[model samples]
Target: MRKLSMAVLVLFLLTSFGIAEAAGSYWQRMAHGYPNQLVVYEYVYEYVSPELEITARVPQLAGASDVNWQDEFNASIRQEVQDLVASLQEAALESLELEQVFQAFPYVGIMDFEVKLNRGGLLSLAIVTYTFTGGAHGMTYYDYINVDLTTGRRLAFTDLFDTEAEIARAAQVINEKIAQEPEWYFIDQFTPGLIAADQGFFLTESQAVICFGLYELAPYAAGIQEFPVSAP
Candidate 1:
């Protein structure tokens, strides 16, 4: 009976040590980096001095000749555009990649906002536009800002003047090229079976990386990374 009890105690101690060792190893990986981990695309923004500012102007009431009218219109427009710029800056700082800014700024008043895409002689742009939904004369003017993502520089200064059309065009071009080839292409290609099992899925390469990333990190995430593996 003493021998039997001794055996039971030894088994319990061994099991407890194994569990503790596993938990310690997991925490160590969490503190450091994962081994044999998949490479994920993370945007490396190069900070530069401000250059251009994009403003959205809302038409004023009564007369365009009134200096106060122009001032008010300009003020309103500047406020709105500044708000947009703030939100965009926040998103850029927080995002893992440039493609994330699309979902981040759905309500930003940029019109005809689209990633310029070219396929077999066909050019396409996802133009997003913002219109005043209500109010006197329907709209007002706000501050403007422009981003040169290629250089990681921004301009909201008067010296950096650019037409709305030009700003939209530049953003679209950047978005399109970024969508086609992200930093995660090689990583995703190496582990295609885990992320892109179906070729029919209309996912951009960047999106595929994100999808796979959520999958790999979900176990440690607080349910925010619960992604659909198979769509209905």
Candidate 2:
């Protein structure tokens, strides 16, 4: 990671100082954007100044059904997840990037993360845990994020970016990375046993678990999950 950062830093410095080799179309293309998956899209659009519109979608994969345990609860969760993804993606394009946001507001340390109110026909729940490695307020952070059943606006968002330019640049970087990754790539994994609902056939743990592995790949995704794990 250090090496990668140094390389990027050096490249940035050289480019900024007009010392690096003139990048060709390929290099420029490489810098354009990373590959993106529609697994679940969170799109945000700045309709006006204060009103940001959001939408979400779920990607249909060849083997998603096989891997995922589907039921009324999970189905509902999936829809909400899809909606949240679309809404957030729009927000990413509209809102500032996390880096810029964090730079703007350095006081809010990310203690946790979350996504809630996903519903298929029934309620669905999921949670993820994370440990911040770098950037932001302070300290190495670790916390869990969850997503569960709800009605209106299954997800909530709070970002720190300032301008659209920053968001575009950051998105470019992520798009590039995703482009270079493998298929399904297994961005995340679920916990051991399914957390079923109270009913005999369903599992509904008050808190759904977030696959830290997948959530971490969030940068690669469109926007951050709606809720922070530690929030009330």
Candidate 3:
């Protein structure tokens, strides 16, 4: 038993060292602007595995710039920022043309990410949260990406698990957790069976975290609900 334990430890150490070597180094880049009087944008983006170009296997993360994940990510952010700025400019111009005095036309958009896990030739997970100001309140949403370090491709749910069984298990766990705080969710909207393929999720060392976006299963006041299910 001691031998087995020692072997496992050695393997873990080796894996960690390899990932560190392969990933090289990364840096954060910030893009900010108040392109017009009405808009405010600040985004801090990450360049992971900067020295290695890996094509993102995941369809959502894949793009023409597949060979360079940083470029792909920056391009997406730039497009979003441009779109937001254009909208804000148009609104400001319309308000001017209409001879209306604007009280509050504040626009705020932020993008942040967390590296959840990286091991075993897998950049296990990254969760990017985008929060923007619009309507009565600011809204935040998440995007989950699991990548193969070797191929630089994003992974889908099927690539990570036995889809049906794991989803069922995870849903069961989430339902039980939510039941403990029933008032936090809309009973009708919060059904375990409703857990879908496209839901946002990431992994910890021993658990799978399933997340529901704001108002998906509850009121926005309840915020985002995450339930962690023990990994099999």
Candidate 4:
């Protein structure tokens, strides 16, 4: 366990310094009245062994007007990466045991992030993780980090919608959308639970994308269901 901790620490140290297999990209978005372009780097970490492999990629921004936003976003993502590595380490132990007993496939964990939206004075990043521990197939999960470019405030459902009426209205929209394709979703999962204060979402030019994970509202075949709500 101590050795594993040391390895995770080393992984963090390496990724914190713009150390990615591939160099970062450039993003041009709207900020105030002018064009805003920021450099995007992949904060990557990797651990490979006989029993398991883990790779993490979080997008880090540079050249933003708000330095505080950049620092806070970086810190929060680093913590998330740390927690994921620890969780994967624990899962890998069980996977190793299962592999020896059942002769199953080795474990694999991967996390990557991308710029999902950058408009309307808001920036949304999508982070996804996939893990396979001797299963029929791997499971994928998602987390989104959204920020207000003007105030550098982290935005949530509450921040986007001001009142319960707005929330209910949004849910109604989602419900209607789901009804349009009832065969592809689970009513019980998305009915009353459609809108939450901290739901995964991203902004676009005209609407906000509300996200659902695999099997949350439908079968894995449906993939992650993203419903668009007219941006508020």
Question: Each prediction's TM-score against the native?
Answer: 0.20, 0.18, 0.60, 0.74
* lDDT score for candidate 1 against the true structure: 0.30
Each candidate: how many clashes?
A: 32, 44, 5, 0
Which segments of candidate 4 are over 4 A away from where they belong? 1-34, 66-69, 97-104, 188-193
Using lDDT, give the best candidate's number.
4
**C-alpha lDDT score of every prediction, in listed order:** 0.30, 0.30, 0.52, 0.70
lDDT of 2 by residue, 1-232 (tens): 9999999999887654323423322112223322212123222222222222222223222211223432443465445444444553455444454444423322211112222222231222233222222354222322222211112122221121123553344334334444565343344322212211221111122222222232444553433322112111
Scanning candidate 1 in windows of ten residues, the lowest lDDT window is 200-209
lDDT of 1 by residue, 1-232 (tens): 9999999998787543233233332213223422211111211112221221233333222222234633564465445445655655564444424444334233223422222222111111222224322232222221122222112122231111134543344334434443455442323222222322221111111211122222232222322121212110
TM-score ranking, best first: 4, 3, 1, 2
Give the C-alpha miss distance for residue 22 in model 2, angstroms.
72
User: Which scores better on TM-score, 2 or 4?
Assistant: 4
lDDT of 4 by residue, 6-99 (tens): 9999877654432331132111122222233556688889888766678888888887766886888788787888887788778777766655
Model 4 lDDT vs. the true structure? 0.70
Provide the lDDT at 23 for model 3. Answer: 40
